[model samples]
Structures are given as structure tokens and as C-alpha cells.
Target: MRKILIVGAGQSGLHLALGLRAHGYAVTLMSNRTPDEIRNGRVMSTQVMFHTALQHERDLGLGFWESQTPRLEGLGISVADPGHGRAVDWLGRLDHYAQSVDQRVKMAAWMETFAQRGGQLVIHGCAVSDIDYFADSYDLVLVAAGRGELVSMFGRDPARCAYGTPQRALAVAYVHGAEPRPEHPGVDAVRCNLVPGVGELFVIPALTVGGRADILFWEGVPGGPLDVFHGVTDPDDHLAVVLQLMEQFTPWEYARVLNVELTDPGGVLAGRFVPTVRRPVASLPGGGLALGVADVVVANDPVTGQGANSAAKCAAVYLEAILARGERPFDAEWMHATFEAYWEQARHVTKWTNTLLGPVPEHVERLFGAAGRLPQVADRIANGFDDPADFEDYFYDPERTDAYLARAAAASAWPGVRGARRIRGA
Candidate 1:
């Protein structure tokens, strides 16, 4: 059996480790913490897995919380006007539902599952020297941890990296008792409230350790009014700051979360990271080559909510590449080609996500304005989260955006036809 050692047990690392184990490979998975530690630790991220990404987990039999998690059937956007009201608003139904499982709950369960399946689980933080010592023991070494000393092994690729600094000051609070949006009563949706020039607030229906809950996430433009959660360490203080910002910038959203409380002491997270893309193959001092996976290679801002999805897709792509290699050595050349294959899909995600981090283009704003009047247009945008590659067709270019909107308008103008056009609310 091919021996593989995976360091870091995040979504990509754990997914790939379990996948290789299922294939009868000798896989040793390393994590910084055990199942209990992870379960009781701080919340990791705000993830909403759409159809394709969720299907990957289902295929692996890792969708343990599927039934318990909230089924987000729609994604709605509310653009806050300068006057503290929404200038543009609409909800777009997704053909396939999306779901968010709190990383604390999901990762802890997955770690236990991997061990119960008879895979070796080592609880240790890996450094450059540690990996160098173990490089010769395994047929392949993959680094999935995107932090600490291991990341410095991979050099940054300046050409592909868009920004040298963090794009948004991010803060998250997972709370219970958030009421449903009045506009979409009884319908569960991911509400994205965009406060122009200041930042955005995303209300996501999620499943946490303490049952069903909502994530009040703020993405504040640096040095802006919304960037006020820097020193707030206490959970209650964090939620307080989050609510204050919401009331000031997005009062409509504040109405729903007035009575919300933290899910747990560790339910709040605040941090920022530079969106970067690094060289796929990292060179060690002993001339051993280690392959960087997922966020270690292509880390994009979470503005478009693609971090977890992209990591899942990267794990899937790398698994296929490993299976296809047969008896061939997992050398540097293979590593580069594997990441390139994944990048073909991931580049679209990176491009779409990075585009949203900057100022909204006029053409894209035009598209958003049109979505309120056209159901087909809104649906297309909503479903694009499932596969961001679809955006390359009509998202970036002005001509393509105009052409797509015109087509949608003409299709909605069919005369004397019942249900030919569904004009959703604005």
C-alpha cells in the first residue's frame, strides 16, 4: 500500500485523509488537537456548502449532520442605501439546498470517524524540521495546515496574489434565537446585507454544537466605521459590538437578531488574513518536497463564501490525482500538475471572490439591480455559488453582463403566457 502522511486536519486535510484510507492506503493523519479539544475549541469559520461541495461529503459518508442542519433553500441580498434603508433587495431560490455545519461540531465528529475507521491519528503540531525528519518515511507528504512555520515552506506567488494586505476586517458570532426575515417569512435563506463603502453583514442559518443557530458575520472595510471589533475578546462583548454595528449600519437585520445570544463561550471568532496564492510545491532544507493543499496554496477572501467549498473541491481533485498516479512516484512535477488541475476550477473561485472584495463594478451593480426584476437572473446568480466557474460567462465583462440581462428581460417579456415571467420583489 502506498504510504501517505497528511499534516493539518482542517476540511481538506481530514477529507483527503479519510478518502485515502477508504481506498486502502496507509494514511497517517496529524492534527493539532483531538476530537474533544476541537469540539470545545473556538469556532473555525462561516461555511455554507452548496450542492456540489456537499455532494462530495455525502459521497464519503461524512454528512452526519445533514438532517439536523438548516436547509438554506435561498440566498438573498439586501443593499443598504445611504439613507439606512435597502435600495436593492431580492431573494433567489436555489435549485438544490445549501447547508452550514459548524466546524466545531463537524470537524470533531469527522476526527472521531477517521479514528473509528482504523486510520492512524496523531495529535501533534508539525513544523518545518519535524516534516523534514519524516519526509523519507512516507511515499507522499501533503501539508494542509495553512498556518505557523509550515506555511513559510511554500513561497508566495506574486503574479497570482492580488493583495498584499487583508481585504476585510472579519468578525463572527454564532447565536441562537435569530428570527426569520420578515420579507421571506418561514423561508430559510442566507441573508447578505451589503452596506456600501463600509462593509457587509451576512446572516447564515447554521447548525452548531448547541443545535440550530444563526451566524452574524461582519466584513468591515479596514479603517471604516464597521471595523470596531479589534480588542473585543469576550463573547458577550463580541456579540455586543456586532449588534451595535448592525443597528447602525443594517438596522433591518438588527430587528431579527435583537434577542439572539451566543451559542457557546467559544462561539465568537475575529481575525483577518491576506488573500494569497503560493507556490504549490514547498522545498525543505533537506531537499524534500512537500505539496501544499487548499488554503495553503490558494487562499482567497471569504467575501464570496468559497473558502470551505474550495477546500472540499481541492481535496476531491487531489484524491483523483493520487488514485490516477498508480505506481508512479509522487514527485514535484506531479504535485505541480495536480495543483494546476485543481486551479483550473479554483482560479474561477479566486477571481470571483477577489472581485467582490474590491469596489463593486458598475456593470455588476447593474446586474444586481436587474436581478430584482428578473427571477431567472436572480436564480442564476444564487446557483452560481454552487459553481463559481459559471460566473466567468456573464460576471466580469460589461458586454457579457449587458447581453445576459437583455436575454433575461426578453425571455421575461413573453406576452399572453402564464407563468412565463416570475418577477420577484425588489
Candidate 2:
């Protein structure tokens, strides 16, 4: 078996480790914490995965929450104006549903799952200097950790990175007793309350530590009133801050969480990180190279909810690249090519995410406005979250948007073309 070392046990690391292990590679996964520690530790993220990424998990037999987790059938998008109160809102249906499995539960189970699959799961915190020494032993080393000393191994690719500062100061909490939406009634879709000029509030149904629950994800725009959760250590305090923010801005959501409480003491987290992309290969002191994987290379803000999905796709793409290079050296050249393959898919995600994090373009805003009136438009936008590849056709630019709308309008006028070919970017 060709020896492989995977650093960090996040979604990408575990997915790749298990996939490689099943393929008969001698894989050793380095994690900072054991299963119990992870399960009881602070919540890492609100991973509300859409279908494309979810299918990847099921293919790997890692969809343990499929039965218990709530099925998000669509996206309930409401653009609330700060001056005008409630504006246009719609529940756009998705062809395939999405699901959110709390990382606390998911990561913990995966660590144990990787171990049971004959992969070595080492519970030790790692640093760059440590990896420099370990890279000599393994045939290939892959770093997938989201943050910490391990993350610093990869240098920023200035040409690809867009933002120099954090776009949003995020505050997230998992809780129970969040009432159903009065509009749709039931956890059928991820309700995203878009407060224009402020930020976003995502109420996602999830399988958490305390069974089925909702994750109230608050993305506060810089210097906004919604960015008030910093320094709140107590879970109760965190919950209170969230409630107050909702009551002040998104009152409709506040009504649903009237009786909501923390899922566990370890369920609330508040922090900020700028979205970044870095060089995939890190040069070690001894002239060896460690390949950066997932967030370590391409980290995006959660505004678009593409973090988890992109990470899952990265692992699968890399696995394909590795298998194709059969009996060949996993050299720096191979690492760069492998990342380029993943980047082909991930670039769409990063573009969509970065576009969303900044000021909304008029053409894109026109799509959002039209989605409320047109079911086809709504469904396409809803499903686009699942597969961002579709975005290259219409979601990114003004000319494409105009072309898509023009084509749809002309088709509607004649009733001759029910389906028109997508407009490719010029």
C-alpha cells in the first residue's frame, strides 16, 4: 500500500482519508481531538449541504444523518428592506433536498468511521514544523485543516484571492424549539432572511447534539448592529444576543425562536475570517512539498453556504486525480495539476460566493427580483446552490443575465420552446 498522510479531520480530510483507505492505501489521518472531544466541543460550522454534495457522502456510505436530519426541499428567500420592512419573499423549490448535520456530531462519527475502515486515526495536534519532518516518511502528504498553525503552510495566491478583510463577522448557534415558518409551515427549506445593506440570517434545520434542531446562523456585515455577539462566552448570552438581533432586524424569525434554547453548552460560536485562496503546494525545509487541500487552499465565507459542498467536491476530485496517476510519483507537478482540476469546479463557487459577499450587482438583483415572480427562475436559483456549475451559464454576469431573461421572454411569447439552450458567457 502506498503510504499517505492526511492532516486535519474536517469534512475534506475525512472524505479523502476514507476514500483512499478503501482503495487499499496505507492512510494515517491526524486529528487534533478524539471522537468524544469533537462531539462535546464547540460547534465548528453550519454545514447545510445541498444534494450534489450529499450524494457524494451517500456514495461513500457517510450519510448517517439522512434518516434523522430534516430534509430541506427548497430555499425560502426573503429580501427585507431596512427602510420598508418586509419586501418580496418566496419559497423556491429544489429538485433535490438539502440537509445540515452539525459538525460536532458528523465529524465525531467520521473520525470513528475512518478508524473502523482500517485507517490509522492519530489524535495529535500538528504544526508546520512537525509536518516538515513527517512528510519525508509518507509517499504524499495532504493538509486539509481549516485553521491553525497547519493552515499557514500554504501561501496566498494573490492573483486568485479577492478580499483583504473579513466581509462579515459571523455568529452561529444551534438550538431547539424554533417554531415552524408561518408561511410554509415545517422545515422544508432553508429560510434565508436577506437584510439588504445589513447581512443574512439563515435558519437551517439540522441533526444536532440534542437531536433534531435549528441552526440560527447570523452573518453580520462589518460595523452593522447585527455584529454584536463578540465577547459573549456564555451560551445563554450568545442565544440572548442572537434573539435581540433578530428582534431588532428580522422580527419574523424572532417569532419562531421565542421559546428556542441552546442545544448544548458547546453549540454556540462567534468569529470572523476573510475568504482566501492559497498556493496548493507548500515547500518543506528539506525540499519536500505538502499539498494543501480544501479550506487550506480555497476558503470562502459562509454567506453562500458553499464551504462544505466545495470541500466535499475537492476530496472527490482529488481522489480521481490520484487514481488516474497510477504508479506515478505524486510530485509537485501532480499536486498543481490536481488542484487545477478541483479549481475548475471550485472557481465557480468562489466567484458566486465573492459576488454575494460584496455589493449585489444590479443584473443579479434583477434575477432575485424575477425569481419571486417566475417559478422556473426560482427553482433554478434554489437548485443552483446544490450545483454551482450551472452558475457559469447565467448567475455571474450581466450580459448572460440579459440573455437568459431575453431567451425566457421570447420563449414565453411564442410558447414554441419550452426549453431553450442555456446562454454561454461571451
Tens-place lDDT digits, model 1, residues 207-297:
9998999999999999999788888888999999999989999999999888999999999999899999999998878888899999999
Give all TM-scores, in the order shown. 0.97, 0.95
Deviation from native of the Cα of residue 178 in model 1, angstroms: 0.9
> What tens-digit string does per-residue lDDT give for candidate 2 at 1-426?
689999999999999998898789999999989999999899999888998899888888899979998888889788887653667687778778899999888999999999998999999899888888898899999999989887787899999999989999999989999877888885478988888888999988889988999899999898988888877888999989998888888888898899988999988999999899999999988888999999999999999898899999999999888778878899989999999999999998898899898878889888888767665667677778987878878888898898887765555444323223222322
Question: What are the candidates' C-alpha RMSDs?
Answer: 2.6, 2.2
Q: Enumerate clash totals for all models, in the order shown.
A: 0, 0
In candidate 2, stretches whose alpha carbon ends up further than 4 angstroms from where it belongs are 409-426
Screening candidate 2 with a backbone cut-off below 3 angstroms (N, C-alpha, C), the clashing residue pairs are none
Weakest 10 consecutive residues, lDDT, candidate 1?
417-426
Model 1 off-target regions past 4 Å? 414-426
Model 1: how far is 289 from its true place, Å?
Answer: 1.1
